[model samples]
Target chain A: MNIEWLSFLTVTLVTLIGSLSLVALYSFAVRLKAIAEDEVRGAGLAKSGAVVCFVLCGCLVLLGIYLIVPQLGGSGGH
Target chain B: MDLTLIVVLVIALALFFDFTNGFHDTANAMATPIATGAIKPKTAVALAAVLNLVGAFLSTEVATTISGGLINEGDNGFSIGPEIIFAGLMGAVVWNMLTWLLGLPSSSSHALFGGLIGAAIAGAGFSVVNYGTVISKVLLPALLAPLIAGLAAYLCTKLAYWVTKRPSGLSSPKRGGFRVGQVFSSSLVALAHGTNDAQKTMGVITLALVASGLQESGSHVHFWVIAACALAIALGTYVGGWRIIATMGTGLTEVKPAQGFSAEASTAAAILASSHLGFALSTTQVASGSVIGSGLGRKGASVQWRTAGKIATGWLFTLPAAAVVGALAATLTYFGNVGLVLVAVIGFGVVLLIWWLSRKDIIGPHNGVSDVDEAGGAISIPTKKQRRKMRKRQREAERAEAERMARELKKAQKNKKKEANGKTKVPTASGSKSRAQEASAPKREARGTKEKR
Candidate 1:
């Protein structure tokens, strides 16, 4: 059997980085939102930071969709 | 004339398989969100249905070669025809329904492949199969996909908790955000499922058309074929396999929103990444693995090893069991038209029987989300025999308890009468003590029996 170990390793690495980063970003955004809600000093800064994190998360989701849909330049072979 | 009819029948069976596939996998994307109360069960199925419908239309590229070259298509080798395809589909559909009734999440793709390989062996010979491809592509991926997804989910869950941990030791206010994120992440999984799974049915139907000389080999799937497959799958998704949902959602582990979000994110990322890299993985296995991973990540959260064991066993059997059914169907089909009709009759009968059996312990949206016990153990719906035995035991216990209570009541009344007499004529201390011991002994025994029950 000709197993593509390289491809499998790449998938594992990509999945780890992609999933962990997205979770971390989303969690950080939630943390910022909580800080802003507390209305402490620099609440405006925290709110802006939360928005940026959310936007980045949204971009990651879009990238995932782009990868899934073949019409959108994704490999799309299941 | 017979060929055309056989091809049409094959298409119909293929569509039915697609329908089963839709329901079988709905749990993969929606179970966690529903379990965590991030989405209502009804709304989650509806959303998944719509996204699946749209995802089916996304691409037909993979549909051209759905088998991924697992079957030998050489000129001298035995060719796969509509009859073989029909038998294979029968096998896949039967296995799919059986697993659904048991509320186990096995791989639909593996079932499809196993059925086809079994049918091919029966119809042609062993040489018709490419064992190398089976081992390399199908078996290897099946073993590895879950482990990779599980690891990813574990790390993602830890990261989510670490970032959201509050100094006050209370649940962070931002935990609600994870619920919102879960909806989107699970949606992506649903959409990807639509793209990946629906295409397999399309490929099967198109292959049938090609074998019947109604379509060209290597040609694009017909628009009607695509639309029909998409609709069948979407309808099935709308119906929702609530039993499997109950198992995946609550049977494996209790999910909080943060954990649900982490699991979904890990599932979606793994699916997209694997597909993008041209490595196929079952959405069901990846999702289940993620749920287990998240369970492991959370402190004090326990995984139901029994339920997990049952699921793993189902996975191990999915291939060979479906193969046996496919082989049997293929053997029957060798008898020609009468055989075909018999296969259809038997298949339809089995479907109805499973549906009938499911009614005794129906799992629906109302109870699907609450199918676990308070202690986070899966509450398996007992089989008919088990239920009957349980009822009998309960009734017997009730009768014994009732008899004990009656005896105690009579003894208490006698004691009261004795006390009345003692008021009139001073009773001996030894007699009172003996009466007290007689009363307490049975009472203690009754309490012991009750505790045992």
Candidate 2:
């Protein structure tokens, strides 16, 4: 069967790119944690909330990336 | 079977699956209330069952998702005709019954979804699979909904306590206001379940109809589909899923009436909101989260992490497992009539095996309730007072045992001092040294050893 190899490959690339965002954000989280720890003025809640927001935003971005990824938007076969 | 007759049978089977979905999830809406003695189990389920039927009529958006989102027309058209849909429904329904029997809150949504995927694949080819739709509509919801619900529950529970620093009087209400709240909340969740869940089957059947040329494209769900699904679900609810209910109500969280009301209310609001937005959010997840939140509401109560862990594991596996099964089933169907026969055989065997396994450690019919019509929980059965008495007796037993141990510890310390030297050495030269060592040993600090380490 002749497949739309380009379309499928594009989807794979998009997925890979989308996955990279997670890695970058994870590093950001580590840095945020270090910063939060260094600053003693904030409540534990604020520190935790900041960490949560970072993670939540990262995930939402990941979802957005997956959804908007050009080739991944459609079922290649159908 | 005649082709048309076979098709009708399949529709009936779809309704049957929808019904099982209703009953299996009844506990999802009302388990905490039942567990807390906030509402009688029978009454809670009865109200839920009625509301679910009414909820089914509330919207068509989720139905459209089922019909159009997952399965495509033409190349990605539904491969399973009525017979295939029937068989798929049977697979899902059998799975539902088995899980209910075992008292496991296996997602009926996934089961039905699995059945369709399996059967469709069996009937068609890899080309028929709508990967995008599967991931976006089904898989994403399956993964995130429960976690979101759990976190929401956790936060909500924390918020409840934070709002009321000391709500000691919450337990003893001057009136039965909490119970009244629980009844209303539970009913709302049941309605939401019906609106979001039952429509799935309707969508599948509609897809099958369009695919088979029995109905035109984009045909609306018929009145018959609605009625059949409603009735089937009501019947399923009536039969009950006692075991799963017990786990949600008591095992995961020690539910109190106020907590139960909060959970049911929260679950209802979340579920209704999700359905309105066309998210086929798992009722189980929403309900479980609400219960976990309730647990949090009652200060000092910790969620049973182990049970939650098991449930998390189940959720993780559900989609991929179903996909594999669907793929295999599809491959077999490619082989035609002979393959269909084998599919039937395997389906029967797998279902029977699951059912047999459920009976292994079954929760009894009483299902952790003692009395039916009693003022609170199974009368003559364990009520709050009885549970408190039992707990008090256990605590006393524990205290006596603890005191005996304390005496023994004191005696042992005295003996050690006698055995060693000079006024119970404090395991250090002086108080500062011992305190220094004690402070350094975090492990020993966790235990907070009364005796110097």
Q: Give candidate 2's error at residue B450 in angstroms.
A: 17
Q: Name the top TM-score candidate.
A: 1
Docking class of 1: acceptable
- Tell how far residue A1 is off in model 1, in angstroms: 3.6
Worst 10 residues of 1 chain B by lDDT: B370-379
Superposed by TM-score, candidate 2 places the C-alpha of residue A42 at a distance from the truth, in angstroms, of 42
Per-residue lDDT of candidate 2, residues B267-355 (tens digit): 55555545544556567765665565445545334345665666666655554455556556546655666765676678667766866
Clashing pairs in 2: B19-B232, B19-B233, B23-B237, B118-B326, B121-B330, B122-B329, B122-B330, B370-B378, B371-B378, B371-B379
Give the backbone clash total of model 1.
0
Best by DockQ: 1
TM-score of each model, paired residue for residue: 0.78, 0.63
